[model samples]
Target chain A: MIVDLRRFLERRRPLWEELDRRLRAVEADPFARIGLDDIRRLHDLYEQVAADLADARELAVRTEVRDHLEALVARAYALVYALEETPARFRPLRWLAAELPQAVRRRARAGVTAAAAFGAGVLLGGAALLADPSARSHLMPFDHLQLHPAERVLAEERQMRAGGDLAGEQAGSFAAMLLVNNVRVSLLAAALGMTFGAGTLALLLYNGVVLGAVCVDFVVAGQTAFLAGWLLPHGSVEIPAILLGGQAGLVLASALLGDGDRRRRVDRLAAAGPDILSLLGGAAVLLVWAAGLEAFLSQYHEPILPYGLKIAIGLMQTAGLAAWLAFGGRWAGRPAP
Target chain B: MIHDGRWLEVETPEGVVFSLPLAGPVARFLAWQIDLAAIAAVATAIAYLTRWAWDLLPDTVAAVNYVAIFVVAAGYHMLLEWRWRGATIGKRALRLRVVDRRGLRLSPVQVVLRNLLRPVDQLPLFNLVGGVAMGLSRHAQRLGDLGANTVVVRVAPVPLPPVEHLTPPRYNSLRDRPHIEARLRRAVPPAAAVLAVRALLRRDEMDAAARVELFREMAAALRQWGALPPELTAGRSDEQIVRNVVDSYFRAPS
Candidate 1:
């Protein structure tokens, strides 16, 4: 059937323009609240334009008008048929007290796997160091870690006695460095879940190996007290934060692998996105706290800050973190009287 | 879910189907380059600002710079895509947008997840992983896009052709014979008519010789299908004859 293309365009141009205007307003400010009347009007306009598009498709000849109408309908369809709920305004307190922990708890299996991976690596690293001391260079690649543990402890004690301010002016800078480096690693661990979790597991294991070698080096040198004082202050929080990142990656991998689930891969990944993001966010926050502690407190030795006080603080922080993850959001979903 | 390597076709519950053009990897890579430059520029600006305050609190200033740069680098795409409805500076400039694979509004989680996974996409240097993934994927999605269930689409505006171009000429000989006009509409294929209209609209953009050759061929094809009278085609130029045939094919009885 032949359409009077000129008359059709002239008659329908206003409706198309109005729909375009409303869409631009909504697109300009995603959070804008539209009134019921406006929403109904928008819906009506969308249907009209959609019908026009259908008519244009049946035109005797294809023209740019059809393409334009399709684009319009495409935009309106996304807004009108969006199935997801509107995002709620961000509340830091609620996120911290409930959402973060709840997401972590929901993915407990992935978390366990991540922790197990790290633990296994730590054991392998410590045994390798114990059996072959000459392999220290291979096991721990850091220059600072290369120093003999006993000699390093002696130097730290000497510095403490001489009133050396090891991190006095540079603590802030050090914390910033730690925060950037740690956060990047954590993000990478989560991102590598696209590798079917292999990359994430390998990273966690490698980190564990380094840690295990360092701990064994100090313990075997008979400086366990100094090691505890130096590492526990930050490692308690930092280690778990990295593990959280690994857990997020594992969750992504599980979704990709699907195991016994029948859903398509895309659907599985979509379902896991929120939890992965939450876990990553929690890891980032914890890493920030750990970075500050590492820079400001972990660097101080016995003379400046007693080993006993630091150990207690580390233990308390660890306990507090454990409790938060275990029970923080237990009552979040409870109905009020 | 039908994809022809260039377009992704999505069907709505209402039975209306639309196609979104998938952005090629080269375009995506260029957009990334622009984004990287934008990030570097922001970081440099922050460094300069921090330098002025370095002497008073060198450590603190340096620390703030580090945090600021990291935030800018990481948050640039996420924040902009979320707020701009899936467009970053680079995307806007390139007329590309990150959209959900199912043709739905992008959720905040999807935005954050896609950008967060960018590090993996860039692994082993220069987006080699992402480039390969885009090549292999049916919908031209990179690894990050797959994880987030998103795809970047081209949003270049398609201009509506002027109505006058399709308007039936006032002195058309075809309009005098109603039976002939009806037969012309049924005889000419929709594809041929569309090509005729497009050639007419973009005639100015073509080389003069090519334009003549194109219209001559199109007119000849239309005549074979349309079977217009000798008197109607006797004096009209090839371009004019094609235009008259298109007009009759599209114009309704008044």
Candidate 2:
């Protein structure tokens, strides 16, 4: 099917291009005089887009690009009424082509209560971090020491082994603990979305700042380069995922605080569907990665990487994010919806 | 929003404004909330500028930020309106706007009052009790809009499409629109009959598609009828020229 479509395209490329160009011209004007011509052009464009989408899907083109292109065609169909009489009406429908953002926003608004709850969660996290001087130094109540308590976690690992093959039992227990703990943290991060957006910001900030402080403390304790062989296996994806979750939470909080103008606030809670899915997927992967580091590398207690290197890496990540947000190819020259 | 009877009206540069029937508590509250947010954004920006001045840009940060924000405020309003005219970026972007008491534009004085009173109308509480009240009111006007004699209303853009003569031997709306078969079914009499057929079939397709086909045929029909002005039919779609002629009726002031 793909091959046939490709051949058809190649054979008809000249005609298609001409049709596309003509339609584009009509789309650009879309006034009354040439309504017949304009509709002809639109018909031509639809056939072309449909064929391209089919071939692109076979080739496994990036999902976002494919989605956008498909959306553009459908959008063209939606507001084409304006084109009916004035053909000039094409521009407005042309503008309204992508409805995903609007749909997402409307869904979000529908779930306002959930959004509000998330917003509240973020506020709690932020307040705790900003108000608490000891937050950085103290155990998070669920981190390495307090929950596990002086190798209590390790002791529990031993019990599993006694009932079966010792190493296998211990390993299973280790994996279970890691999974459970990571789940709690991820949930915490998402929930901290309340208190407007400040809560989410505070959560991310606290995590980031604590990591920075702890690394400094560990190094001073002379476990120099503690992370070189310690965190490499998972920290890369895990830490970033945590931050992503925090960002999602932040967005949720802001919406609850009545972000955007009335027209923009179509819906609130459901707005986070895509964002939530993305965050969850990212966080899940990072959690596994974090587990790998804890089990295989973190236990080794090697010298940490140089502070300067860690700082540099962190800064680089931040720069990359800024670049993605600013000049990212995702939006290109199009104004964000 | 649906209204049954005639109401008071105000004219302005933005669009026509209608006084929402009667003021109510709920509308009043929502309006207050709207003001409250506006105040907060402005205040927060001001506070940030003050801090930046005290710490970051010692010599001119404060002045720069102040002027920059002021210009931004006015520039944003003027640019969106002069270009889009019907709505400012915030209103258009947010899907809301300020117009006359009869769904028209707010006058220059109204604009100044509504924007300038941002501080008094918006701030002073960690909560937004007043905003909710404004929203509950009929007019959707906060203190500023009410005092300034301006009305705020939801805006819908004029969707001007071409009015064209329809053409057809007969085409199915569900199927792709058939291209003109080059060989006419017959030389047939005047061009008017072909258009009449297309328009007749159009009522069946759908509101939107019908509009498109109608516009297309209308122009061709007009030409055949010898009604279109020569300048308009020079090259562009007759519908476009027609649209421009109609849009002139509601454009903002120079």
Candidate 3:
């Protein structure tokens, strides 16, 4: 049976328009402006639209008519059901200041475990590098090994290390690559936590060993001071950020582990939703800063800038970051009266 | 020919049913490609602009470019999804919108969670893992959407149909008595009312016996509520009486 859309629209348009207007008004000002009357009207209109949409389907109505009604009803449905405005946006800063620290504190056990595992890897790698020179080649990637040669490293260390004279295009690409790689590693660490956290642990171990091996390489090559000047500026923030990724992975693992027999594993993951978000969010924020430091200060040592000043700046940055994490959200998590 | 994916049926407290047409993998992939292209375009623009500015502070180029790329890659989705009601530019272009699976407003936490897991979804290379997960999932939701309890729905505007005008015989006897009208409206399922209208519109198509049986069944059901007044039913045929009652109920005020 053919349904006359034009005829049907002439009769129903007024009701649909009225409903649309009311919904628009309520959406615009959700507070004191919408009274009981508006709510009732919205509800009534939503029901009407829903019924109309169903009828349109059954009657084989015009596609345009069906599409228009479907969208209208969907909008009305969302507004009616989602009346409570969840103020979740415009407060990423708050998430960082309050929620992130609280999350780290709540999951301190996991964070500590991650840190310990990383530290163990570092120590093991450092010991191996010191004992056998071959371990240095094994631990460092080919590109990394290429970055600094033993002879060139020593030669550069003899003079105040002038930063590499990279062209604008080269520097831009380098920066992009660095940021992408760092964030990718961090996200990978966090995601690998889904493998019951063993993957996360392995990544942490690998990273720690590489870092430790590189440190030993610098020490053996007599570039400890240069390494400190380069790493400390960004390492102060970057390492913590990476650790946060580790913490995130551990949190995922914990969620899986913490699922007592009663709840589903997915439910446990859901329960740990905030912690996961906080860890990931915090890590991303830290990575942005680290990227900035590594790209700018670590790469560039102005001819006049002393190594002592760089070391001092790195130290200060590390201390400041530590203090912020320790006390960032001290009072925000308190129970409301 | 758009092959709409699976339908998710949601029944509201008011007994209204909504059948949401879920977006399929093909549409979602296209949307992702659009977003990816947009991000790349923005990154390229920044690369050129950064190159120009880097001559003055060459060492800071990496830092500046790093931030520029990061913001474009990650921040684009978050800001647009949150502010534009769960639609990225790609999603918007495809007429798709992300909505909470349970019909709640998409919260900030959910947005962040979904986007953060994006890299994970692109696991190993490309979005192979995500595509597989989406294909296997009930709602065609990728890992992030599943984790965040959200779904992307295709939203097409459905124009309202004109009301059916069956000129009443002077007075809608049913409408005259508000109590009985309200009771009948409440007791009758929306489907039944729609069926009644369809039956009236297409009576000629049905065989005489089938038509009689259909109205007899409907009239019997309508009377079971014991709200039909004698005046409205005195000598009216079962079909006419049922049609009048359904019409009056539809015309009732909010």
What total of clashing residue pairs does each candidate reach? Answer: 0, 95, 13
State the lDDT of candidate 1 residue by residue for B1-254, as single tens digits: 22234887877667777788899998899999999999999999999978988889889998999999999999999999887878888998998998889777788999999988999989899999999999999999999899999999888776566666665454779888898898888898878777888788777779999999998999888888878778989988888898788777777676
The DockQ of each candidate is 0.58, 0.01, 0.22
TM-score for each candidate, following the candidate numbering: 0.93, 0.29, 0.71
Off by over 4 Å in 1: A1-3, A21-39, A82-84, A334-337, B1-5, B186-191, B212-238
Error of 1 at A200 (Å): 1.0
Q: In candidate 1, what are the lDDT values of residues A1-337, reduced to their tens digit?
A: 4377667877898899899899889977877877878778888888898888878877643557777887788888888866225666677788789888988888999999999999999998999999999999999998888899999988988888998884767889999999999999899989989999999999999999988999899999998888898998899999999999999999999999996779999889888887898899999999999999999899999788998888888999999999999998788962121
State, as a TM-score between 0 and 1, how close model 3 is to the true structure.
Answer: 0.71
Candidate 2 ranges beyond 4 A from true positions: A1-169, A264-272, A301-337, B1-254
Ordered from best to worst TM-score, the candidate numbers read 1, 3, 2
**How large is the interface RMSD of each prediction?**
2.9, 24.7, 6.4
- Give the alpha carbon lDDT tens digit for every residue of B1-254 in model 3: 13446866666666656667888888888998999999999999998987876668765676667767877888899888877777887998897888888655587777877787777678878788888988898888887787677888886544343334343444557767778877877888867766766566566668999989998888887877646766678887778777676666566343
Which lDDT value does model 1 have at A68?
Answer: 81
Pairs with steric clashes in candidate 1: none
- DockQ score for candidate 1: 0.58
For candidate 2, write residues A1-337 as lDDT tens digits.
Answer: 2322223334544544465456445434424255575567675565565565445454211232234333333333322432432211223332223222232233343234343443444455445545663564462433552332224323543543444332322443454456456644554555445345564555565555555544444443455444333344345545655655555455555555666635332244334433443444445555665665454434432122343455455455456533433343334243332
